[model samples]
Target chain A: MTACVIMGSGNIGTDLMYKVLRSYTLDLRALVGIDPDSEGLHRAADMGVDTSASGVKWVIDNADSINLVFEATSAGIHRSHAPEYERLGITAIDLTPARIGPSVVPGVNLKDHLEAPNVNLITCGGQATTPIVAAICRAASVPYAEIISTVASNSAGPGTRANIDEFTETTSACLEEVGGAGIGKAIMILNPADPPIMMRNTVYCGLADGYDPERVVESIVQTVDNVRTYVPGYQLKRAPVFENGPFATPGGVVQTRVVVLLEVSGAADFLPAYAGNLDIMTAAAVRVGEALGAARTGGRT
Target chain B: MTAAFRLTDSTLRDGSHAIRHQFTVDQVRAVVRGLDRAGVEVIEVAHGDGLGGSSFNYGFSRIDEMDLIRAAVDEADNARIAVLLLPGIGTKDDLVHAANIGASVARIATHSTEADISHQHMALAKDLGMETVGFLMLSHMVASGDLLDQAKRMESYGADAVYVVDSAGAMTIRDTMERISMLKHGLDCGVGLHAHNNLSLAVANSLAAIGEGIDQVDGCLIGLGAGAGNCPTEILVAACDKAGYETGIDLTELLDVATDVVRPLSPNQGVIDRDGLMLGYAGVYGSFLLHAKRAAEVYGVACDDILLELGRRGIVGGQEDMIIDVALELRQAADSSDAPR
Candidate 1:
């Protein structure tokens, strides 16, 4: 069985590789890592994985059955190399926010990518919230929705700046797909978590023109339950409440309050979700990958 | 005395925390435009974490050194463009870039009492021909006398002015006045005050600082800043006007900036709303407002209770963003059915 090859070795790379290794039940044939940092490469070596300090192309030659590659390098590096990696037979899963590939979230569009060559993971925030978005879409069968994820500023990292635009776009796309609609807004907030906080996501859903607000709220709550099944960190922060008044809705049209709390694992000092939360998001990704693989196999054979 | 105050808007830089660096160029331009119209003298737009910007914590909204200076150039053509360059996050090259691109002032900020770090930025600013202001965060962390010593040290290092930043928004008017008086008496340079409204005393404390002879009034328009926000430029300007202080700004435009600009850009968040008042009463620092708000969203708790609860948790000083952690803890405690509600 061919497992996705994860490249780069930063926070995203390290976590994604570990999750892929743990969840898939099969050993990743070529978990190649290309990093100049000796410490990172040493860590990968210690993990009993292949380490490639040379160019990415050199690593490509080592594997014959590369099903997919996950690129978790910095934004600048990912932007320059991700597209080329996609062109190769290996389907690239970019966890970095460089926005070089089509944005993807597991369970929402895992089946769509099994045949495709490459895809990008939207963001830690989006990955945590999109299922709820999809669940909202599934429940309401609405025409539109919006998601506002306000995170602790400490949670906003290098990948955040590198992929701000994509975060908005991917979130919007997920909302549209979930609602089976078009043109939704997704706002990501990076708040300075003083005592620092575990990362969390908030979703705001708006229905098609003149739809019942009650129905939308009911559907979103139901979606949250489904999401909580796999993502335990998810909690319904605020039950869907109707906020209709001046300045309630930014655009003056969408009047809905659907807030969900995601209590992710945090460092001991509560300095937001550092490497520990990265591990949780990565683990979720692997779970989705396995589901995708099963669905692909089940559908094909 | 002109009876007006100058505003140094930092929404593009400090406010980037709320959005993480995902702010669009359009958003940056929009924020700058509002601040400019509000008669803000200096608009600080760039990476709050500094020029080197870490990948894990840097917000995309952080304009590169040159780009940030350039983007803010048009909006602040008349207003002096300032960039905050953290010592470790920036280099001499960043100072040089800021100076070349028309940055009139470089607020060289460092942790309060950290003289070496302040001196490094101050020296770099002087070399680049930029007005070198030394900002000491969490000014109340030490006694007024101790701060006076640091202020004198900063002046000796070539700092044009010494800025007392209430990073924790924890100071009272007495604290501000005492700090300003000390700086005025001990240092040859001018004194400045950057107040946080976490205690709802930002305006009062800033006025008191000015009364004690602080020359520069650092503010953000409509208080669109980190924590409860800095003293609202309009409110501060009006108070200064009534008090007959000279700030070299138009009071009318400052009011207009609040009404038309900051109020709209950050419509519901960080305003002096009821929640903001609660935060102040609770002695929660300014930076924690957004996090508390997020926690409120996450825990299904009323946003009103977050600050008070956080305050009770002994989270104070510059640790404003930790309110969310407290909120999450409260949630966990409530969920376990073990602790008292």
Candidate 2:
């Protein structure tokens, strides 16, 4: 089994460690964090995985057994650590918005980038919405797509808060680069409601004149189903809503516009079910990691 | 105790809601030029919901917000271009795009109790070297002490100023005084107020907030905004001038803009209609006025009932979808009662 090490013991890192521990194809190596007092490190120790406070440097020093590195640190930290992971020949699955590697949304285009040295799981918003964008693009000529992702306030960690700029830039870039939209805009909301709400996404895509809504809806449903494979909690909050437009588009007036609403409930592995933002990211990372690991093992027992 | 006050013209931003997000590019250019000539320090331009907010749910913008921002920036020679960004409605990328197009200031807003969410956006705006204001909408929903706590969070997040936004237009003189005074006392950054004229008190409340040492205040030309409308920039400037406060705004130019540029664009003059007054009385969010109206029509319920029920339930911004659900419930209850026993 390909052994994996999760670097950073924050919310995303801890959740990823839990996901990695349960993966049948990838073995959990260690949970590395800078804070020795972090509860994530203690939880890892309790789960019988090796724990360290030395962070990625320690992971590199002991790189013999680790084949994959999950870099869950901040975007700035990931920028420095990415090249080191590359030099050490350890495949890094980055959870930060650093975008050091090609962006991958597993449900949409994971197989295309499996052989790459490093893969970025974009932002939580990208992971949740891009697949749907990709689906629409596959069926029609999408001129512009905009997404708004709202997650519970409590679910946002310091890392998530600090990387807000990267989250929007990287997610919007990936919508064009990976999801194949002509132009993309991303918005993120942190809902501070008590009994914290689940992660919800609103995706709006502008279609060229005379495009078929039925065909577009079919493609979107297929993509939603594909995402549900890894993220069982993911579901369409409502069916795709289409509007005939005098709506302004980058390429003049659009014939039709499509709106799709999505919600993600967490599996409650580490964080609460409200933290579907973290769940979707970690879940996508696991799907990508296991697929890469399985390819390396050639499906051998 | 007199302090120099900065005036923000939000006719292009908040006023978009009053017009159903249909502000044309030509309109933005004209209004912006007028506001700049009138000596308004800041001119905010975007979809009423902010950048990246043109969608079916929020009501699509007739023109893309970026194009409007570019137009406003091109027209305004002296006024600093600003944009109101609800954290969830617009992102840092949108801010970057706005800044690139010469938007010099960003009001990063959130629900009053959710100021923590503005931290990242505020930090990003600061890093980009733009003047940042943390805006707490629906300030009436929280107590003065709680509002102070939220304002302090924004101040800590690198905001140059923090605003107590009466998004519902629900604050009275007492409400404004207690909250603004507490914020002025507790926060290290500058204090600002954004008032809605739902109760025809936008000017009165602005005066009260100014009395409590608010450094900046927002208004729209001709009082064009959500609910009854925002504080009318022209009227507020006149009032400030009469009260012996210095606003640095030209009353003559503001009057021309209000009469010529803004008034023609407004669908109706900004006045306290029943729905508008009910918003202030019910303490509902100003932005929710349109959404609640639509839901009221869809579910065959009175808009007033929806507003009152939403206020009772403590619905806040980002919960726009709840308007429909509440309207539906209200309709269903009414239906059951109307049926034969």
Candidate 3:
């Protein structure tokens, strides 16, 4: 079994712990957090996984045993710890928006960056929308694309609040790099409601040329299915709405435009199921970790 | 009368929404000249949604916002130019670039409950040698305590001032008094107010805020802003003069800006039509008035119903895409209801 440690035993780390526990390839090593009184650490210890309150210090001390590490802490925390993981020869799957490594959306470009020392799972909005944008671009030429990611206010913790700038910058960069859009704009909104709203994304793309509605629709649906293998709750709200005419975008005007709306419901492991915004990050990280683990152990999927 | 509060004119920034983000360089130059002549201390210039707001979601600005900012800076003889930026829509680079162009003030805005998101931008503005103002949009949605907490977060981030913005124009005089007083007492930073005229209470709410010793307030010439418009700068100055408060502005010159420069452009600047009234009634965002009207015509739904439902869903700004989606859903509902039951 390939040994692994999940760092930062917060909501994301604990939820990731449950995901790794269910993994058949990755061998759970320990859950590390800075707070000794954290509920996430207590729950992990109760579930028979080793728990450490020493944070990155524990990972540095126990580096010989762990094959991989998941950085679930804030971007600033991950930035300082990523080099240690690299020096220890442990592959780091970064959940924060720290762009120390090339961004990897498993459905889009995970295979290309499997050998990198650290790989960033861009923001939740990036993981959820980048694959669809990439799929549509493969079917046509997309010049400009804009995405708005809305999440429940109740699901956004203080960490998420402080990193709103990082969220938009990382997500927008992912769209242009992996999704093949010439220009990308990202906006995030946190909605406060009684029963929290599921993570919903609205994507508007200005197709420049070489496009067909039937082909683009098929490509998008296929990409959704591919992502659903890891995240079962990811889905398109309905058929994408297409319009033919002059569409005014910041980059320029496009004669053909496509509007796509989708939603994600979480697996309800550590956080409420409405927090699919947080869930997609852990789910994508697990998929990448499993791929790296299987390759290390020489196990067949 | 002693001028008690610092006045910032937003005819260029917010008024861009009234003209669909199509402000020309000449228009900006002429308007800034007028405001500068009228002794307007700080004049704001940017796209309706702030810097870098031109996109597929919000309609594209006719000219680049940076060039317009440069124009405003060049034309204003005494008034310093200010620009607005929402964190998710505009980045720190935009702030740095604006400062390089001689703009001296940056108003970093966010939804009332989400001021934590504006911390970095506020700090960045402070570092850029510009005055930083933490602008909380849609302040009426949260109570005084909640608003105070958000304002304090902005203050801790190095914001020099914090503005309680009623983006929906839904705040009553009492609501205005409560939030302004809380911010004034709770934080070390100065407090400001940005009121809209949707409820026909823009002047009343500004008066309430001024009565609480607000350090700064926003107004647009002749109230030429989105939906029902903002507190008319001409009228606000006149009211300050009458209330025995000091505004230090030459009211006659401001009236010249309203009567000569703006009125010719937006003839219906102060008209509160059905759609405009629905914004205040349903507590919908003032900017959504245009988006909802476009989507309503496209989906064949009543504009008022669209605004009411968006208000019910409690969508703050930054969710402009939801306006079209909700309108389409309302259309589908209408179609289904018309079908055989």
Stronger candidate by TM-score (1 vs 3): 3
- Please report the candidate that would top lDDT against the real structure: 3
Docking quality (DockQ) for each candidate? 0.02, 0.27, 0.65
| Docking class for candidate 2 | acceptable
Q: Residue by residue across A160-225, what tens digits does model 2's lDDT show?
A: 665566677788788899999988877776666677778888888888866778899999999899
CA lDDT, every model vs. true structure: 0.61, 0.85, 0.89
Residue-level error in angstroms, candidate 1, position A109:
2.7
The number of clashing residue pairs in each candidate reads 27, 2, 2
TM-score of chain B of each: 0.79, 0.96, 0.98
- Model 3 error, position B161 (Å): 2.1
Contacts from the true interface found in each model, as a fraction, amount to 0.00, 0.33, 0.65
TM-score of chain A of 3: 0.97
Order the candidate numbers by DockQ, best to worst.
Answer: 3, 2, 1
lDDT of 1 by residue, A213-252 (tens): 5666676677666655545556665454443311122223
Comparing 2 with 3 on lDDT, the higher-scoring candidate is 3
Best by TM-score: 3
* lDDT, candidate 2, B125-211, per-residue tens: 999999999899889988999999988989998999999999989999899999999999998899999999998889999998888
